[model samples]
Target: MDYQNSLAFAQEQDRQDPLHHFRERFYFPQVNKQDAIYFCGNSLGLQPKSAQMYIDNEMYKWANLAVEGHFKGEEPWVTYHELLAGGAARVVGAKESEVVIMNQLTVNLHLMLVSFYRPQGKRFKIMVEGGAFPSDQYALETQTKFHGYNPDEAIIEIFPREGEHTLRTEDILQSIQEHGEELALVMMGGINYYTGQVFDMEAITKAGHEVGALVGFDLAHAAGNVLLRLHDWDVDFAVWCTYKYLNSGPGGTSGVFVHERFGKDPSVLRFAGWWGHNAKERFLMEKGFKPMEGAPGWQVSNGQILPMAVHRASLELFDQAGMENLRQKSERLTGYLEYLIDAVPVGKDVIEMITPRDPQARGCQLSLLVKRNARQLFDKLMESGIIVDYREPNVIRVAPTPLYNSYEEVYRFSEILHECLEGC
Candidate 1:
């Protein structure tokens, strides 16, 4: 599809867009007293207009029902987390029973690592992509240290070839096979946070299993942004936060997907709590820990109502938009962003896209590697009311999300960027 660099063309696209209305469902942050063109959904999503109403409902329930809210309200606090399972499962392409909306992303990662990362005998090494998000790197390091293994020796960091910005899928699969013998677990981000590169999780998971290694992914950037089939991919375990593309509030609730195989196994080792026990016998105050049927069995505590209320508000929007529809619009929206960026002729040395060109290999984000005055350019964007984000060293990330961003906004952003580039 040929893209034109004109406001009229962008307006036409917006006019025809099916998901365009979703943009109005959110309140954009003001810049210079006007709505800023927000391209920062990859870092934090815009709050849903209905979020306050959802919060109010819960607040009212607590005010009126008090302790009885646990069992008496329309959505009982006791089973509140369960209300999110269907939406969370749909977003990540997992069974309802296999998905649990709980804990933060890093916390869930640690919990999943405890259950999946079992290094024994001669096989003790963990393989991960080099320069992973700091949280993942730290989690793997501490887990290895906890198991009495030297991190440098116990973790293998695979990097791209000398000049490339993204990992080749073939290279990753080959590396997995080469180190198959010593590999105890394969941990990677579904989408690299820095480069916005989406890894081939299905192939990676298959390769890991072939080597007798358990596989998992950190999908903080993938969930609600890309097409995922964790259950179909046979991913052992995965975790993600909802604050980014999911449009939940900041520091929002997270979700975990445990394959049915593990969820059904009562003997599986987990740091369980009272809520993870059987619901029928929860009030018995029993001495033994009898696990629930599926992913809920891994819960460490009862549901969180306030955060989940806000989450539920956003989930309702996802239910209306549909992931498949969102993906279709996302490809076009992000592809247009790339086309406009390339047309800028910013000079390859000055600025270029580090994100994969293939729409299938990326989500809504395009990471621009600015060789000169990266921070200056980012600040200019903010000052101009174009809300994007900057990463360390020299990368500026912009994500024109399908739910809230319009084509006209994307066009305008390029024009502002062109103006901003002159001074930088």
Candidate 2:
């Protein structure tokens, strides 16, 4: 597994990789008929090859069956979302009834907030990790305001002590203890978007529950990149998008998870729609809404089939390969990336790894804090056909996806980065 500045060693690792065959399942993005070394799977995953066939089938059904497609088509457009649950459950480590493929990430967050963030009197405070994705921060702020609370006072933003890029587990646990009395809910990303730090979910969940506050996560960065056990960890809810790591295409359909414990709670207060109504009674067009007794009860409408079809297609591949296999490859692939990044002479002061060094504490992403123009370095890599992503200011994110990226790709990227630094 230690390639150690050895290209031959890297190639040997690739040759021996059991999951190497899974790389061919994706349609690698290319220019001039060559497969690009795509390390930006953290931003957007390469499309699964089966996605086309799945969408094509749905397209043909829609074209020929028209309105009848909902009830009579082979897949039954009316219940298309149901097809996604089993795969999603496996991905997030939840029961089938606890996972639901529904609206986009942000919308689902707002919906979960409706049920979980019931600010009452002294316990009106909501806690969110500092430096959360902008969309999540905005959602929390807006939701707090909607409840007639000043965001500054009601929303507690927990940050690492000064000079730390990532929060310490102890700091998070302590914050939860200090604010537990006033906290209504604790919402955080499973893996931080920028630093790639995977939070201690078990600790967070237990702390939040001890204070009688609901806990949830936005799993956009973690969904397919890391293994989760939401059910055992006692997470109250979670939301995630399929574009990143899930390889469901850009801005594709999203999913939600609600603990089975809350499935029948009438007071859960979801934003209901026809799709959420009991399936058997749906055709009856009953005057009142009787929600399906699971996470599907949160659905607002039948999901757009095109995107869900693509997601399903991607999930089929994931189901076949199994997450354990992916995680095994991922650990080694990402470790190789870390080793390469460290081997190159970038000057210790010029480069710092913001991601946790512990394998279990991070996914495939390695967020580099560059001292100079990170964007310039990023552009140079792009020109040289080594694709990586740049966050604003001076950070470059390199995600060597195990499903497609090779150890050789990581070594080549290091070589290019070293060359780029030499010119500057």
Candidate 3:
């Protein structure tokens, strides 16, 4: 597709977009008394229009049914999280039984690590990406310490070579091979947050397994943004927050994926709770902890109705739009953003794009390394009602989400950015 930098071209593209109607489903933030051009879905997605209705329905249930809402209300709070398993499975490419909606991301990561990150004798090292999300870094550090190993010795962080901004596939594969013998687990983010680079999870999984190591991923950035096949890729476990691309509310409930092999295994070590016990036998309150059959068995508590309600509302939209359709639009939308940015006279010299040029290596996000007046530029865009985010130092991250963001919005942003740069 030849992308033109004109507003007419952007409008034409929006006219042809099959998923254009999805933009109406969300409520955008106000900017200058009009809908802002929201390019921050990589941070937090806009609220769905139906989210309030969904929450209200649950509130009604709680008001009317009280404790009986667990069994009697519409959808039943006792097994409310179950409502999400099929949709969550489709997003992550897992079996229904292999997926569960549960605690927030880092908590789920810790729970998965409890079962999968077993280090025995000499094979005690954990391999991870160098600049992992701080939560993951802390989780790995503490987990290593809990097992009586020094974090400095037990954790191996693979960094990008020299001046490169992202990890090369070959470099990652080679590192896995080099540490094969001592590696107890291979854990990484499915996509790097700062760079917006999608990792090759299938390749990573194969490499980890070939070396007799378990593999898992924190899919916070990747889950709704990219195509994933956690089950087919033989990923041992994975966790993701729904607020970003999934468009759930802030601090939304997260989803987890466990391969069928472990999902069916009752003997796996987990910090169990009553909600995870077999549903049929749960009422008896018997002593033995006979776990539920699959990923639901990992649940440490009962569902939080309000958050799950908001999540279900968004998942319904995803089901209607389909991930494949969303991905197609995403590629074109992000590509258009790139094209428009490049057409600016000062774009090449004033700002550097750190994300990979290849679409397969990234999602909707474009991380710009702004060389001059970065904060001022970001503030100018903000004041103009263009909603993008600025990271520390000098990076501005813009995400043109396929579901709600428009091509015209991308074009408008480029024009605004160009004007700001010229004045600076």
Candidate 4:
């Protein structure tokens, strides 16, 4: 699809967009009493308009039903998380039974690691991407230490080749094979947070398995942003936060996927809680820990109703829009963003796109390595009500989300950025 860096072209695309109505469903942040052009969904998505109503419904249930809300409410609190499983499963490409809405992302990662990261004898090393999200780094570091292995030795980081900004799939697969004998688990972000490079999870999963290692992903960026097939890819496990592309509230409840093979395996280690016990016998207060049949069995506590409510509101929108439709718009939206950036004289000279050029290798995010006045330029955007984010050093991350972002907004951002650079 050829893209033009003009407002008319952008407006034309917006007019033709099937998902254009989705923009009105979200409440954008106010900057100077105007709706800001939000390009920060990679960080936190705009709140859905129905989120308040969803939360209010749960609040009403709690007020009227009290403890009885557990079972007596219109949609019982006891099974609230269950209602989310199907939608969350669709978002991550997993069967309903293979997915569960549960604890925070890092916590879920730790839980999955406990079961899948078991290292025996010489096969204790964990392979991960270098410069992973800090939480993942810390989780792997602490988990290695907890298992009485020195992190420096037990953790192998796969770094991009010299001067490269993203990991090549070939390099990743080769690394997996090189450490095959000692690798116990291969854990990576489905999409790299900084570069916005979508990893080839299917190939990575196959490579890990070929090496006799379990594979998992932290899909925090990939969940609602890119197409995923955790089950078909044979990903052993995965975890994601819903707040970013999923448009759940801040610190929202996360979703987890445990492959059907591990879903009900009695031998798999997990931090068990009452909620994860067999629902039929749960009220009996039985002494034994009889796990639920699938992914819910990994739940360590009862659900958080309010967060789950907000999540449900957004998931409903996703259900209506469909991931495939969203992806189609996303490619064009992000492609237009890339095109506009390149067409802008200042953008071409001062901004370097670190994200993969191929649509299939990235989601909505494009990480710009700003050559000059990065902070000032980011502040300029903020002052102009163009919502985007700046990372440390020189990177500015822009995400033109399909659910709410507009192509015209992307064009406007390029104009603003060009003006900012000219002023600099």
Tens digit of per-residue lDDT, candidate 1, span 59-127 = 999899999999996788999998999998999999999999887889999999989999998899999
Q: lDDT tens digits, residues 287-396, model 3?
A: 99989989999998998889999999999998999999999999999999998888899777889999999999999999999998899989988998989899888999
| Per-model TM values vs. the true structure | 0.99, 0.98, 0.99, 0.99
Query: Which residue runs does candidate 2 get wrong by more than 4 Å?
Result: none
lDDT of 2 at 286: 74
Q: What clash pairs does model 4 have?
A: none
Model 1 per-residue lDDT at 323: 98
Candidate 3 backbone overlaps, count:
0
| Model 4 regions more than 4 Å off | none
**How many clashing pairs in candidate 1?**
0
Output the TM-score of candidate 2: 0.98
Instruction: Please report, as a residue range, the 10-residue window in candidate 4 with the lowest summed lDDT.
Output: 340-349
The per-candidate count of clashes, in order, stands at 0, 0, 0, 0
**lDDT digits (tens) for residues 1-424 of candidate 4:** 9888778998998899989999999998899999899999999998999999999998898888899999894699889998999999999999999999988999999988888899999999999999899999999999999999999999999999999999999999999999999999999999999999999999999999999999999999999998888899999999999999999989999999999998868668887889989989988997988889889999889998999999999999999999999999999889988887888886677889999999999999999999988999889889999988988889999999999888899999989988888887
Winner by lDDT between candidate 4 and candidate 1? 1
Off by over 4 Å in 1: none
